[model samples]
Target: MQLLLLVDNNDRAFLSDINLYKNEQGKFIPRNQCIKLKDTQGREISLLSHIDNSDLYGAIFTKFTVVSSSRFINETVILRGTNKHGQDVFLGLLLDKYEFRSFLDKEDELCLFISDLDEICIFLNNNNYLGSGLINERSDKQLFIDLKNNMVKLKPKMNHKEKFCTSFRFFNKDNIMVNSIIIPVELSNIGATNTTTVTLK
Candidate 1:
Protein backbone atom coordinates (compact mmCIF):
# COMPACT_ATOMS: atom_id res chain seq x y z
CA MET A 1 0.00 0.00 0.00
CA GLN A 2 1.03 3.65 -0.33
CA LEU A 3 2.75 4.81 2.81
CA LEU A 4 2.63 8.28 4.35
CA LEU A 5 5.68 8.73 6.51
CA LEU A 6 5.78 11.44 9.15
CA VAL A 7 9.11 13.16 9.70
CA ASP A 8 10.58 16.01 11.70
CA ASN A 9 11.77 19.31 10.31
CA ASN A 10 15.20 17.83 9.66
CA ASP A 11 13.90 15.35 7.14
CA ARG A 12 14.96 12.52 9.44
CA ALA A 13 13.05 9.28 9.50
CA PHE A 14 10.47 9.64 12.22
CA LEU A 15 7.98 6.86 11.64
CA SER A 16 7.85 4.14 8.98
CA ASP A 17 5.19 1.49 8.46
CA ILE A 18 2.16 0.49 6.50
CA ASN A 19 -1.54 0.61 7.19
CA LEU A 20 -3.28 -2.66 7.99
CA TYR A 21 -6.89 -3.58 8.36
CA LYS A 22 -8.34 -5.19 11.48
CA ASN A 23 -11.71 -6.82 11.79
CA GLU A 24 -13.95 -4.95 14.15
CA GLN A 25 -17.65 -5.53 14.71
CA GLY A 26 -17.99 -7.29 11.38
CA LYS A 27 -16.23 -4.36 9.74
CA PHE A 28 -12.62 -3.32 9.21
CA ILE A 29 -10.73 -0.52 10.87
CA PRO A 30 -7.37 0.50 9.44
CA ARG A 31 -4.48 0.64 11.85
CA ASN A 32 -0.90 1.78 11.63
CA GLN A 33 1.91 -0.73 11.39
CA CYS A 34 4.76 1.24 12.99
CA ILE A 35 5.62 2.92 16.25
CA LYS A 36 5.37 6.65 16.73
CA LEU A 37 8.42 8.92 16.68
CA LYS A 38 8.79 12.31 18.34
CA ASP A 39 9.88 15.32 16.40
CA THR A 40 12.07 18.18 17.64
CA GLN A 41 9.10 19.61 19.50
CA GLY A 42 8.29 16.27 21.05
CA ARG A 43 5.26 15.94 18.82
CA GLU A 44 4.40 12.42 17.81
CA ILE A 45 4.39 11.60 14.11
CA SER A 46 3.12 8.49 12.36
CA LEU A 47 3.03 6.86 8.97
CA LEU A 48 -0.30 6.24 7.31
CA SER A 49 -1.37 4.50 4.17
CA HIS A 50 -4.62 5.04 2.30
CA ILE A 51 -4.40 3.00 -0.89
CA ASP A 52 -1.91 0.81 -2.71
CA ASN A 53 1.41 2.18 -3.86
CA SER A 54 0.25 2.45 -7.45
CA ASP A 55 -2.63 4.79 -6.66
CA LEU A 56 -1.27 6.57 -3.60
CA TYR A 57 1.67 8.15 -5.31
CA GLY A 58 -0.40 9.12 -8.27
CA ALA A 59 -3.05 10.86 -6.17
CA ILE A 60 -0.56 12.85 -4.13
CA PHE A 61 1.30 13.88 -7.27
CA THR A 62 -1.75 15.85 -8.30
CA LYS A 63 -1.70 19.54 -7.50
CA PHE A 64 -3.82 20.47 -4.50
CA THR A 65 -4.54 23.09 -1.85
CA VAL A 66 -4.25 22.86 1.92
CA VAL A 67 -6.73 24.70 4.12
CA SER A 68 -6.40 24.85 7.88
CA SER A 69 -9.25 25.96 10.11
CA SER A 70 -9.93 25.83 13.80
CA ARG A 71 -11.94 27.61 16.45
CA PHE A 72 -9.28 30.30 16.36
CA ILE A 73 -7.45 29.99 13.08
CA ASN A 74 -8.22 29.70 9.36
CA GLU A 75 -5.92 29.83 6.35
CA THR A 76 -5.40 28.33 2.91
CA VAL A 77 -2.27 27.01 1.18
CA ILE A 78 -1.94 25.77 -2.38
CA LEU A 79 0.64 23.42 -3.82
CA ARG A 80 1.28 21.40 -6.96
CA GLY A 81 2.67 17.95 -7.63
CA THR A 82 3.87 15.91 -10.61
CA ASN A 83 1.97 12.99 -12.08
CA LYS A 84 2.49 10.35 -14.78
CA HIS A 85 -0.33 11.68 -16.96
CA GLY A 86 1.63 14.85 -17.79
CA GLN A 87 -1.08 16.80 -15.94
CA ASP A 88 0.13 18.41 -12.75
CA VAL A 89 -1.53 17.25 -9.56
CA PHE A 90 -3.02 19.73 -7.13
CA LEU A 91 -3.94 18.77 -3.59
CA GLY A 92 -5.89 20.67 -1.00
CA LEU A 93 -6.69 19.67 2.58
CA LEU A 94 -7.31 21.08 6.01
CA LEU A 95 -4.61 20.58 8.64
CA ASP A 96 -4.51 21.00 12.34
CA LYS A 97 -3.75 24.59 13.34
CA TYR A 98 -0.47 23.88 15.10
CA GLU A 99 0.66 21.30 12.58
CA PHE A 100 1.77 23.88 10.02
CA ARG A 101 4.53 25.26 12.22
CA SER A 102 5.70 21.85 13.37
CA PHE A 103 8.47 21.91 10.77
CA LEU A 104 10.01 25.29 11.60
CA ASP A 105 13.77 24.96 11.92
CA LYS A 106 16.46 27.59 11.61
CA GLU A 107 19.22 25.01 11.72
CA ASP A 108 20.68 23.09 8.80
CA GLU A 109 17.65 20.87 8.45
CA LEU A 110 13.91 21.42 8.09
CA CYS A 111 11.32 19.00 9.41
CA LEU A 112 8.41 17.55 7.43
CA PHE A 113 4.94 16.46 8.39
CA ILE A 114 5.12 13.76 5.74
CA SER A 115 8.32 11.74 5.44
CA ASP A 116 7.50 9.26 2.74
CA LEU A 117 10.31 9.50 0.21
CA ASP A 118 8.12 8.61 -2.72
CA GLU A 119 5.40 11.05 -1.72
CA ILE A 120 7.89 13.80 -1.05
CA CYS A 121 9.54 13.20 -4.39
CA ILE A 122 6.23 13.42 -6.11
CA PHE A 123 5.35 16.65 -4.29
CA LEU A 124 8.64 18.29 -5.11
CA ASN A 125 8.58 17.13 -8.71
CA ASN A 126 5.31 18.83 -9.62
CA ASN A 127 5.74 22.32 -8.22
CA ASN A 128 3.92 25.56 -9.04
CA TYR A 129 2.80 28.93 -7.65
CA LEU A 130 0.22 29.40 -4.90
CA GLY A 131 -1.52 32.36 -3.31
CA SER A 132 -3.58 33.33 -0.26
CA GLY A 133 -6.15 36.01 0.44
CA LEU A 134 -6.41 38.17 3.55
CA ILE A 135 -5.58 36.46 6.82
CA ASN A 136 -6.90 38.95 9.35
CA GLU A 137 -9.56 36.52 10.48
CA ARG A 138 -7.17 34.39 12.45
CA SER A 139 -8.11 34.65 16.13
CA ASP A 140 -5.40 32.37 17.45
CA LYS A 141 -2.51 34.54 18.48
CA GLN A 142 -0.32 31.56 19.25
CA LEU A 143 -0.92 30.10 15.85
CA PHE A 144 0.10 33.36 14.23
CA ILE A 145 3.24 33.49 16.33
CA ASP A 146 4.17 29.97 15.34
CA LEU A 147 3.43 30.66 11.70
CA LYS A 148 5.55 33.79 11.81
CA ASN A 149 8.36 31.80 13.36
CA ASN A 150 8.08 29.19 10.65
CA MET A 151 8.24 31.90 8.01
CA VAL A 152 11.43 33.17 9.55
CA LYS A 153 12.92 29.72 9.44
CA LEU A 154 12.04 29.54 5.76
CA LYS A 155 14.69 32.24 5.23
CA PRO A 156 12.48 34.72 3.48
CA LYS A 157 14.70 37.66 2.54
CA MET A 158 11.88 40.17 2.44
CA ASN A 159 8.46 39.90 4.09
CA HIS A 160 5.58 42.30 4.06
CA LYS A 161 2.45 42.61 6.12
CA GLU A 162 -0.50 44.16 4.36
CA LYS A 163 -4.28 43.90 4.15
CA PHE A 164 -4.24 42.19 0.80
CA CYS A 165 -3.84 38.79 -0.81
CA THR A 166 -0.47 37.18 -1.36
CA SER A 167 0.73 34.35 -3.54
CA PHE A 168 3.87 32.33 -4.30
CA ARG A 169 5.50 31.73 -7.67
CA PHE A 170 8.34 29.46 -8.74
CA PHE A 171 10.69 30.10 -11.67
CA ASN A 172 12.87 27.01 -11.69
CA LYS A 173 12.96 26.28 -15.38
CA ASP A 174 16.58 25.10 -15.22
CA ASN A 175 17.42 24.76 -11.53
CA ILE A 176 15.31 24.37 -8.43
CA MET A 177 14.61 27.54 -6.50
CA VAL A 178 12.34 28.92 -3.83
CA ASN A 179 8.97 30.41 -4.72
CA SER A 180 8.35 34.11 -4.12
CA ILE A 181 5.32 35.65 -2.42
CA ILE A 182 3.65 38.57 -4.18
CA ILE A 183 1.09 41.02 -2.86
CA PRO A 184 -1.11 43.58 -4.55
CA VAL A 185 -2.60 46.51 -2.69
CA GLU A 186 -4.85 49.43 -3.49
CA LEU A 187 -4.23 52.85 -2.04
CA SER A 188 -7.04 55.06 -0.86
CA ASN A 189 -6.73 57.45 -3.80
CA ILE A 190 -4.43 55.53 -6.10
CA GLY A 191 -5.86 52.84 -8.33
CA ALA A 192 -3.69 49.84 -7.44
CA THR A 193 -0.30 49.63 -5.80
CA ASN A 194 2.19 46.86 -5.25
CA THR A 195 3.58 46.54 -1.77
CA THR A 196 6.56 44.50 -0.53
CA THR A 197 7.59 41.07 -1.85
CA VAL A 198 8.82 38.05 0.06
CA THR A 199 11.54 36.24 -1.82
CA LEU A 200 12.13 32.63 -0.87
CA LYS A 201 15.68 31.87 -1.93
Candidate 2:
Protein backbone atom coordinates (compact mmCIF):
# COMPACT_ATOMS: atom_id res chain seq x y z
CA MET A 1 0.00 0.00 0.00
CA GLN A 2 1.24 3.47 -0.94
CA LEU A 3 0.28 6.35 1.36
CA LEU A 4 1.02 10.04 0.99
CA LEU A 5 1.26 11.54 4.45
CA LEU A 6 1.44 15.21 5.38
CA VAL A 7 2.16 16.11 9.02
CA ASP A 8 1.96 19.75 9.99
CA ASN A 9 2.31 21.63 13.24
CA ASN A 10 1.90 25.42 13.41
CA ASP A 11 5.59 26.22 13.13
CA ARG A 12 6.72 23.46 10.80
CA ALA A 13 5.51 21.18 7.99
CA PHE A 14 7.24 18.00 6.83
CA LEU A 15 6.86 15.08 4.43
CA SER A 16 8.02 11.59 5.20
CA ASP A 17 8.27 8.08 3.81
CA ILE A 18 6.01 5.54 5.52
CA ASN A 19 6.66 1.94 4.49
CA LEU A 20 4.98 -1.21 5.76
CA TYR A 21 6.14 -4.77 5.42
CA LYS A 22 5.53 -8.30 6.61
CA ASN A 23 8.21 -10.01 8.66
CA GLU A 24 9.37 -13.64 8.59
CA GLN A 25 6.99 -14.42 11.43
CA GLY A 26 4.08 -13.13 9.33
CA LYS A 27 3.86 -9.97 11.38
CA PHE A 28 3.62 -6.53 9.87
CA ILE A 29 6.67 -4.32 10.45
CA PRO A 30 6.80 -0.63 9.63
CA ARG A 31 10.05 1.19 8.94
CA ASN A 32 11.90 3.83 6.88
CA GLN A 33 9.73 6.49 8.52
CA CYS A 34 11.26 9.97 8.51
CA ILE A 35 10.05 13.56 8.15
CA LYS A 36 11.37 16.36 5.94
CA LEU A 37 10.14 19.78 4.92
CA LYS A 38 10.25 21.84 1.75
CA ASP A 39 9.16 25.30 0.63
CA THR A 40 6.31 26.06 -1.78
CA GLN A 41 8.88 26.07 -4.56
CA GLY A 42 9.95 22.47 -3.76
CA ARG A 43 13.31 22.92 -2.06
CA GLU A 44 14.37 20.16 0.33
CA ILE A 45 14.51 21.36 3.92
CA SER A 46 17.85 20.51 5.49
CA LEU A 47 17.45 18.31 8.55
CA LEU A 48 21.12 18.29 9.32
CA SER A 49 23.20 20.63 11.53
CA HIS A 50 20.47 20.98 14.15
CA ILE A 51 20.50 20.33 17.90
CA ASP A 52 18.72 17.02 18.53
CA ASN A 53 16.75 16.21 21.63
CA SER A 54 15.34 12.70 21.69
CA ASP A 55 12.91 13.60 24.42
CA LEU A 56 9.76 14.55 22.54
CA TYR A 57 7.14 15.64 25.08
CA GLY A 58 3.82 17.40 24.70
CA ALA A 59 4.41 17.42 20.99
CA ILE A 60 1.02 17.40 19.33
CA PHE A 61 0.70 15.54 16.01
CA THR A 62 -1.86 17.81 14.39
CA LYS A 63 -3.42 18.06 10.93
CA PHE A 64 -2.41 14.48 10.16
CA THR A 65 -3.68 13.44 6.72
CA VAL A 66 -3.10 10.14 4.96
CA VAL A 67 -3.95 9.07 1.41
CA SER A 68 -3.60 5.47 0.31
CA SER A 69 -4.90 3.02 -2.28
CA SER A 70 -8.30 1.35 -2.77
CA ARG A 71 -6.78 -1.89 -1.56
CA PHE A 72 -6.88 -0.20 1.86
CA ILE A 73 -10.54 0.73 1.42
CA ASN A 74 -12.03 -1.17 4.33
CA GLU A 75 -8.84 -2.37 6.03
CA THR A 76 -7.35 -0.60 9.01
CA VAL A 77 -3.69 0.39 9.08
CA ILE A 78 -1.90 0.16 12.41
CA LEU A 79 0.04 3.19 13.58
CA ARG A 80 2.55 3.63 16.41
CA GLY A 81 3.69 7.01 17.65
CA THR A 82 6.72 7.66 19.86
CA ASN A 83 6.45 11.11 21.34
CA LYS A 84 9.33 13.25 22.54
CA HIS A 85 8.71 12.00 26.07
CA GLY A 86 9.36 8.39 24.98
CA GLN A 87 5.69 7.55 25.39
CA ASP A 88 4.19 5.12 22.88
CA VAL A 89 0.71 5.55 21.44
CA PHE A 90 -1.47 3.31 19.32
CA LEU A 91 -3.90 4.49 16.68
CA GLY A 92 -6.62 2.52 14.90
CA LEU A 93 -7.53 3.53 11.37
CA LEU A 94 -11.06 3.72 10.01
CA LEU A 95 -11.64 4.66 6.42
CA ASP A 96 -13.58 7.92 6.59
CA LYS A 97 -16.99 6.95 5.14
CA TYR A 98 -17.73 10.52 4.06
CA GLU A 99 -14.41 10.92 2.30
CA PHE A 100 -14.69 7.48 0.72
CA ARG A 101 -17.93 8.54 -0.96
CA SER A 102 -16.62 11.94 -1.95
CA PHE A 103 -13.53 10.43 -3.59
CA LEU A 104 -14.95 7.26 -5.11
CA ASP A 105 -13.58 7.79 -8.60
CA LYS A 106 -10.21 8.41 -7.06
CA GLU A 107 -10.49 5.24 -5.02
CA ASP A 108 -6.75 4.86 -4.87
CA GLU A 109 -6.62 7.86 -2.55
CA LEU A 110 -7.78 7.55 1.08
CA CYS A 111 -7.72 10.45 3.54
CA LEU A 112 -7.91 10.50 7.39
CA PHE A 113 -7.66 13.30 9.93
CA ILE A 114 -6.46 12.90 13.53
CA SER A 115 -7.13 15.77 15.93
CA ASP A 116 -5.39 14.82 19.20
CA LEU A 117 -2.99 11.91 19.45
CA ASP A 118 -3.18 11.89 23.25
CA GLU A 119 -6.85 10.93 23.29
CA ILE A 120 -6.04 7.87 21.24
CA CYS A 121 -3.14 7.07 23.54
CA ILE A 122 -5.43 7.26 26.56
CA PHE A 123 -7.90 4.90 24.91
CA LEU A 124 -5.27 2.32 23.98
CA ASN A 125 -2.74 2.87 26.73
CA ASN A 126 -3.44 -0.58 28.11
CA ASN A 127 -4.37 -2.78 25.15
CA ASN A 128 -2.31 -5.24 23.12
CA TYR A 129 -2.82 -5.77 19.38
CA LEU A 130 -3.30 -8.78 17.18
CA GLY A 131 -2.49 -9.02 13.50
CA SER A 132 -3.37 -5.96 11.46
CA GLY A 133 -4.42 -4.27 14.67
CA LEU A 134 -7.60 -6.35 15.03
CA ILE A 135 -8.25 -5.67 18.73
CA ASN A 136 -10.27 -8.01 20.92
CA GLU A 137 -12.26 -6.22 23.59
CA ARG A 138 -11.68 -7.69 27.08
CA SER A 139 -15.28 -7.50 28.25
CA ASP A 140 -18.25 -9.83 27.95
CA LYS A 141 -18.89 -8.64 24.41
CA GLN A 142 -18.56 -10.52 21.14
CA LEU A 143 -18.48 -9.26 17.59
CA PHE A 144 -19.64 -11.47 14.72
CA ILE A 145 -16.93 -12.85 12.51
CA ASP A 146 -17.08 -15.47 9.80
CA LEU A 147 -15.05 -18.54 10.71
CA LYS A 148 -15.04 -22.30 10.12
CA ASN A 149 -15.05 -23.25 13.78
CA ASN A 150 -18.39 -21.78 14.93
CA MET A 151 -20.75 -22.49 12.02
CA VAL A 152 -24.29 -23.49 12.87
CA LYS A 153 -26.24 -26.21 11.05
CA LEU A 154 -29.47 -24.23 10.75
CA LYS A 155 -30.41 -22.37 7.57
CA PRO A 156 -29.49 -18.73 7.41
CA LYS A 157 -32.29 -16.34 8.44
CA MET A 158 -31.54 -13.62 5.93
CA ASN A 159 -33.11 -13.81 2.47
CA HIS A 160 -30.65 -11.64 0.59
CA LYS A 161 -28.02 -13.70 -1.22
CA GLU A 162 -25.47 -10.91 -0.94
CA LYS A 163 -25.92 -10.84 2.82
CA PHE A 164 -25.23 -14.52 3.31
CA CYS A 165 -21.59 -15.49 3.56
CA THR A 166 -20.00 -18.94 3.50
CA SER A 167 -18.27 -18.63 6.84
CA PHE A 168 -21.29 -17.61 8.93
CA ARG A 169 -20.90 -18.73 12.54
CA PHE A 170 -21.53 -17.88 16.19
CA PHE A 171 -19.47 -15.09 17.68
CA ASN A 172 -17.61 -16.53 20.67
CA LYS A 173 -16.25 -19.65 22.32
CA ASP A 174 -19.60 -20.02 24.11
CA ASN A 175 -21.40 -19.98 20.71
CA ILE A 176 -23.44 -16.90 21.49
CA MET A 177 -25.41 -15.56 18.56
CA VAL A 178 -24.39 -11.99 18.01
CA ASN A 179 -27.08 -9.33 17.77
CA SER A 180 -27.86 -7.44 14.58
CA ILE A 181 -25.54 -4.61 15.60
CA ILE A 182 -22.21 -4.78 17.38
CA ILE A 183 -21.41 -2.65 20.39
CA PRO A 184 -17.87 -1.81 21.42
CA VAL A 185 -16.95 -2.20 25.09
CA GLU A 186 -13.96 -0.30 26.34
CA LEU A 187 -11.66 -0.68 29.36
CA SER A 188 -13.17 2.24 31.25
CA ASN A 189 -16.66 0.75 31.15
CA ILE A 190 -18.31 -1.90 33.40
CA GLY A 191 -15.78 -1.57 36.22
CA ALA A 192 -13.00 -3.01 34.08
CA THR A 193 -9.84 -1.02 33.50
CA ASN A 194 -7.13 -3.03 31.77
CA THR A 195 -5.50 -3.35 28.41
CA THR A 196 -7.08 -5.96 26.15
CA THR A 197 -4.53 -8.62 25.32
CA VAL A 198 -4.31 -10.33 21.92
CA THR A 199 -2.91 -13.84 21.82
CA LEU A 200 -2.59 -15.92 18.66
CA LYS A 201 -3.13 -19.59 19.13
Candidate 3:
Protein backbone atom coordinates (compact mmCIF):
# COMPACT_ATOMS: atom_id res chain seq x y z
CA MET A 1 0.00 0.00 0.00
CA GLN A 2 1.15 3.52 -0.85
CA LEU A 3 -0.24 7.02 -0.38
CA LEU A 4 -0.68 9.66 -3.08
CA LEU A 5 -0.80 13.33 -2.21
CA LEU A 6 -2.47 15.55 -4.76
CA VAL A 7 -2.11 19.31 -4.64
CA ASP A 8 -4.46 21.19 -6.89
CA ASN A 9 -3.98 24.55 -8.53
CA ASN A 10 -5.80 26.18 -5.64
CA ASP A 11 -3.18 24.71 -3.33
CA ARG A 12 -5.73 22.44 -1.70
CA ALA A 13 -4.19 19.07 -0.78
CA PHE A 14 -5.84 15.66 -0.85
CA LEU A 15 -4.53 12.29 0.22
CA SER A 16 -5.57 8.91 -1.19
CA ASP A 17 -4.44 5.29 -1.19
CA ILE A 18 -2.71 3.57 -4.10
CA ASN A 19 -3.47 -0.15 -4.14
CA LEU A 20 -0.93 -2.55 -5.63
CA TYR A 21 -1.37 -6.04 -7.08
CA LYS A 22 0.86 -8.67 -8.59
CA ASN A 23 0.46 -9.08 -12.33
CA GLU A 24 0.85 -12.24 -14.43
CA GLN A 25 4.48 -11.25 -14.98
CA GLY A 26 5.09 -11.54 -11.22
CA LYS A 27 5.54 -7.80 -11.02
CA PHE A 28 3.64 -5.35 -8.84
CA ILE A 29 1.29 -2.94 -10.55
CA PRO A 30 -1.08 -0.24 -9.36
CA ARG A 31 -4.78 -0.80 -9.94
CA ASN A 32 -6.45 1.74 -12.19
CA GLN A 33 -9.13 2.82 -9.78
CA CYS A 34 -10.74 6.21 -9.51
CA ILE A 35 -8.95 8.42 -7.00
CA LYS A 36 -11.37 10.35 -4.82
CA LEU A 37 -11.10 12.58 -1.78
CA LYS A 38 -13.61 14.37 0.39
CA ASP A 39 -14.00 18.11 0.10
CA THR A 40 -14.61 20.61 2.89
CA GLN A 41 -18.32 19.99 2.55
CA GLY A 42 -17.70 16.24 3.10
CA ARG A 43 -18.85 15.52 -0.42
CA GLU A 44 -16.75 12.96 -2.22
CA ILE A 45 -15.19 14.59 -5.27
CA SER A 46 -13.39 12.65 -7.97
CA LEU A 47 -9.93 13.93 -8.75
CA LEU A 48 -8.57 11.34 -11.14
CA SER A 49 -10.53 8.68 -13.03
CA HIS A 50 -10.39 6.44 -16.10
CA ILE A 51 -6.75 5.74 -15.51
CA ASP A 52 -5.65 3.48 -18.36
CA ASN A 53 -2.62 1.16 -18.35
CA SER A 54 -1.78 1.87 -14.75
CA ASP A 55 1.68 0.31 -14.20
CA LEU A 56 4.06 0.90 -11.30
CA TYR A 57 6.35 -1.95 -12.38
CA GLY A 58 7.30 -3.05 -8.85
CA ALA A 59 8.47 0.43 -8.01
CA ILE A 60 6.92 0.87 -4.57
CA PHE A 61 7.22 4.06 -2.64
CA THR A 62 6.09 5.04 0.82
CA LYS A 63 4.50 8.18 -0.54
CA PHE A 64 3.89 9.93 -3.85
CA THR A 65 3.55 13.68 -4.31
CA VAL A 66 1.79 15.25 -7.30
CA VAL A 67 1.52 18.96 -7.92
CA SER A 68 -0.45 20.62 -10.70
CA SER A 69 0.33 24.11 -11.90
CA SER A 70 -1.06 26.29 -14.70
CA ARG A 71 0.95 29.23 -15.92
CA PHE A 72 0.62 31.76 -18.70
CA ILE A 73 1.46 29.34 -21.49
CA ASN A 74 1.55 25.83 -20.02
CA GLU A 75 -0.09 23.47 -17.56
CA THR A 76 2.15 20.95 -15.79
CA VAL A 77 1.76 17.92 -13.58
CA ILE A 78 4.91 17.19 -11.62
CA LEU A 79 5.46 13.74 -10.00
CA ARG A 80 8.30 13.03 -7.58
CA GLY A 81 9.21 9.82 -5.78
CA THR A 82 12.00 7.47 -4.84
CA ASN A 83 11.13 3.81 -5.18
CA LYS A 84 12.25 0.96 -2.92
CA HIS A 85 14.79 -0.05 -5.59
CA GLY A 86 17.02 2.86 -4.63
CA GLN A 87 16.08 4.78 -7.73
CA ASP A 88 14.78 8.33 -8.04
CA VAL A 89 11.93 8.87 -10.48
CA PHE A 90 11.05 12.27 -11.90
CA LEU A 91 8.08 12.62 -14.20
CA GLY A 92 6.74 15.81 -15.76
CA LEU A 93 3.89 16.70 -18.07
CA LEU A 94 4.04 19.80 -20.25
CA LEU A 95 0.84 20.63 -22.03
CA ASP A 96 -0.53 23.39 -24.24
CA LYS A 97 -0.15 26.82 -22.68
CA TYR A 98 -2.99 29.29 -21.99
CA GLU A 99 -5.55 26.51 -22.15
CA PHE A 100 -6.68 27.11 -18.57
CA ARG A 101 -5.67 30.71 -18.03
CA SER A 102 -9.14 32.05 -18.64
CA PHE A 103 -10.78 29.86 -16.03
CA LEU A 104 -7.91 30.35 -13.62
CA ASP A 105 -7.97 34.09 -14.07
CA LYS A 106 -11.64 34.10 -13.19
CA GLU A 107 -10.97 32.00 -10.06
CA ASP A 108 -13.34 29.33 -11.28
CA GLU A 109 -13.18 25.94 -9.61
CA LEU A 110 -11.81 23.37 -12.01
CA CYS A 111 -11.72 19.60 -11.58
CA LEU A 112 -8.67 17.55 -12.48
CA PHE A 113 -8.91 14.62 -14.92
CA ILE A 114 -6.08 12.17 -15.55
CA SER A 115 -6.06 9.39 -18.14
CA ASP A 116 -3.94 7.33 -20.56
CA LEU A 117 -1.40 4.62 -19.73
CA ASP A 118 2.35 4.64 -19.00
CA GLU A 119 2.19 8.17 -20.30
CA ILE A 120 -0.25 9.63 -17.77
CA CYS A 121 -2.51 12.33 -19.11
CA ILE A 122 -3.78 15.10 -16.80
CA PHE A 123 -6.64 17.42 -17.61
CA LEU A 124 -7.60 20.78 -16.16
CA ASN A 125 -10.60 22.55 -17.73
CA ASN A 126 -10.11 20.04 -20.60
CA ASN A 127 -6.31 20.33 -20.98
CA ASN A 128 -3.92 17.38 -20.54
CA TYR A 129 -0.29 16.19 -20.02
CA LEU A 130 1.64 12.87 -19.74
CA GLY A 131 3.52 11.99 -16.51
CA SER A 132 4.45 9.00 -14.24
CA GLY A 133 6.87 8.15 -11.37
CA LEU A 134 7.25 6.98 -7.72
CA ILE A 135 8.57 8.97 -4.73
CA ASN A 136 10.28 7.60 -1.61
CA GLU A 137 13.31 7.68 0.71
CA ARG A 138 14.77 10.70 2.55
CA SER A 139 12.90 13.74 3.79
CA ASP A 140 15.07 16.37 2.18
CA LYS A 141 14.40 15.79 -1.50
CA GLN A 142 14.88 19.04 -3.42
CA LEU A 143 13.15 19.98 -6.66
CA PHE A 144 13.98 22.81 -9.00
CA ILE A 145 11.16 24.22 -11.11
CA ASP A 146 12.29 26.08 -14.21
CA LEU A 147 9.17 27.84 -15.37
CA LYS A 148 11.03 29.55 -18.22
CA ASN A 149 11.77 26.19 -19.85
CA ASN A 150 8.78 24.22 -18.51
CA MET A 151 10.95 21.69 -16.64
CA VAL A 152 11.14 20.18 -13.16
CA LYS A 153 14.25 18.40 -11.81
CA LEU A 154 14.96 16.55 -8.58
CA LYS A 155 18.23 17.05 -6.72
CA PRO A 156 19.02 14.07 -4.51
CA LYS A 157 20.93 14.43 -1.24
CA MET A 158 23.00 11.29 -1.57
CA ASN A 159 26.68 11.47 -2.43
CA HIS A 160 27.02 8.53 -4.84
CA LYS A 161 25.73 8.19 -8.39
CA GLU A 162 22.06 7.27 -8.22
CA LYS A 163 19.76 5.67 -10.72
CA PHE A 164 17.50 8.43 -11.98
CA CYS A 165 14.66 7.61 -14.32
CA THR A 166 12.60 10.28 -16.08
CA SER A 167 9.71 10.54 -18.52
CA PHE A 168 8.70 13.94 -19.86
CA ARG A 169 6.13 14.75 -22.47
CA PHE A 170 5.34 17.89 -24.46
CA PHE A 171 1.87 18.19 -25.95
CA ASN A 172 0.53 20.98 -28.10
CA LYS A 173 -2.54 21.58 -30.19
CA ASP A 174 -0.82 20.05 -33.21
CA ASN A 175 2.08 17.84 -32.11
CA ILE A 176 2.50 15.27 -29.35
CA MET A 177 5.81 13.66 -28.39
CA VAL A 178 7.00 11.76 -25.33
CA ASN A 179 10.56 10.98 -24.25
CA SER A 180 11.21 8.33 -21.61
CA ILE A 181 14.69 7.32 -20.47
CA ILE A 182 16.66 6.02 -17.52
CA ILE A 183 19.91 7.77 -16.67
CA PRO A 184 22.30 8.01 -13.76
CA VAL A 185 22.52 11.40 -12.03
CA GLU A 186 25.41 12.56 -9.91
CA LEU A 187 24.48 13.79 -6.42
CA SER A 188 25.99 17.05 -5.26
CA ASN A 189 25.28 19.96 -2.94
CA ILE A 190 21.66 20.97 -3.31
CA GLY A 191 21.24 24.74 -2.87
CA ALA A 192 17.59 25.04 -3.79
CA THR A 193 15.54 25.90 -0.73
CA ASN A 194 12.30 25.37 -2.55
CA THR A 195 11.74 21.62 -2.07
CA THR A 196 9.34 18.85 -1.04
CA THR A 197 10.50 16.22 1.44
CA VAL A 198 9.19 12.64 1.60
CA THR A 199 10.48 10.55 4.50
CA LEU A 200 10.21 6.76 4.08
CA LYS A 201 10.55 4.01 6.62
Best model per TM-score: 3
Ten consecutive residues with minimal summed lDDT in candidate 3? 103-112
Q: Residue-wise lDDT of candidate 1 within 1-201, one digit each (tens)?
A: 122323323433321122323445533233432223234243333222221222213222222223322211323333344333344333222233333223221121221334433322212110111211122333223223323322311212233243334443322222233344443321122236533332222
Error of 2 at 149 (Å): 27
| CA RMSD (A), model 1 | 15.7
Better of 2 and 3 by TM-score: 3
Candidate 3 C-alpha lDDT tens digits along 39-118:
32422333334222123222333422233222113335344444334576544444444422222232111112323211
Task: For each candidate in the order shown, give its overall lDDT on alpha carbons.
Answer: 0.28, 0.24, 0.32
Clashing pairs in 3: 73-97, 81-134, 81-135, 82-135, 82-136
Q: For this target, which candidate reaches the highest lDDT against the unseen true structure?
A: 3
- Sorting all predicted structures by TM-score, with the top scorer first, yields 3, 1, 2
Cα-based RMSD of candidate 3: 18.0
List the candidates ranked by lDDT, beginning with the highest: 3, 1, 2
Clashes of each: 18, 4, 5
**Per-residue lDDT of model 2, residues 112-137, tens digit only:** 22233221112111121111111233
